[model samples]
Target: MTDDDDLRTRLHRADPAADVPPTAPDRVSRLLEKTMTTTTAAPRRTTALRPTRLITLAAAAVVLIAALGTWFVLRPDNTPGAPVAAPTVTEITAPGIAAKCAEPTADRLTEAADLAFAGTVTTIDGRIVTLEVTNVFRGAPTDVVRVAQTGDISETMMGSGKFEVGRDYLVASSEGSMLTCGYSGEASSPGLAGLYDTAF
Candidate 1:
């Protein structure tokens, strides 16, 4: 026999399925179909999961967007408003009488003066003078005091002898009337503080 025929014979003897009967075409076709269905089925299922994962991600994104929108709409405002307080005012009217005065004594001040304080003049509108109370020497605490300047200031008052805006004064009052004749005057008046200290 030729070398090619000899090699074919050797290969055929060594083949593991050489003695097996040949498969029929119809059976082979069924096996091929089954194999195609089994191998391709796993890939089809895997491809379907991609769309499902995409849909899940889309749903999560929508929920996150909705939550953020709600927070923005319902957020609390932090704007500031006015915080200044209105001052409490105490009104006292000074007597307009120009009377013959006697020497002001601490004994008289203690007996007659019911309210005494140190204050700064804030405004003067016609015969009305407004003072912002600084320190209360006697009586209830007050933020402001208004006095009606009905007459000339006593010559005994220190500084200008009259109420002037932005200047501090020591004042004493009884029954809603300002005391004059050295009993109330500028804060820097000599002996005035000593008199107040002795009186109250």
Candidate 2:
């Protein structure tokens, strides 16, 4: 047989039941058509997400603005309000005593140091008398006096009658120094310096 005939026989024998029919020109045409279709068709489109992205950004910006506004409104003022009133320094005096007695007995008695108070005489032993002055502006007894005299100073100076307990006395002394009051003798008792320094 000829060479061409022999090659065709071998190809036919390799796949005799195969459905693919050999046609060089037809196969070339089909491949060209497929290439044209692919090239001419539009490209797959990516979804447009700009609108959704813009909305999310706008929401975040609104939240930030709201937070800033709230903070500004709630901020405290640096300058405060008016000052408060100080406690009244009311010096209680003896009933019926003239207001002029508020002054110091003498210039040698130092400045008006007697802290006017209203309270009862706590104790009165011979030569030593303790007055428990209360309702004091500053808490606790502000003054304690040790009166040094020849006779009962409470009755002598206060009056000829007896100095009863709970009877209030508006006392003036040499600088509100605490000493045994209503006594008359040469006994020296330590004066009360700062009685209300800590008691208050």
Q: Among these predicted structures, which one has the highest TM-score?
A: 1
Per-candidate alpha-carbon RMSD to the true structure: 38.2, 42.2
Please identify model 1 stretches exceeding 4 Å from their true place: 1-85, 154-156
Per-residue lDDT of candidate 2, residues 44-75 (tens digit): 11101122322332333334233433422332
Candidate 1 overall lDDT versus native: 0.65
Which lDDT value does model 1 have at 138? 72
Query: Per-residue alpha-carbon lDDT of model 1 for 1-200, expressed as tens digits?
Result: 69999999999899999778999999999998667533322112122123333343333333423443342233221212211144447788777556767888999999998888776676689999987554566766565689987667656465568887756677999998888888988765677767877887
Return the TM-score for each candidate structure: 0.55, 0.26
Prediction-by-prediction clash tally: 0, 10
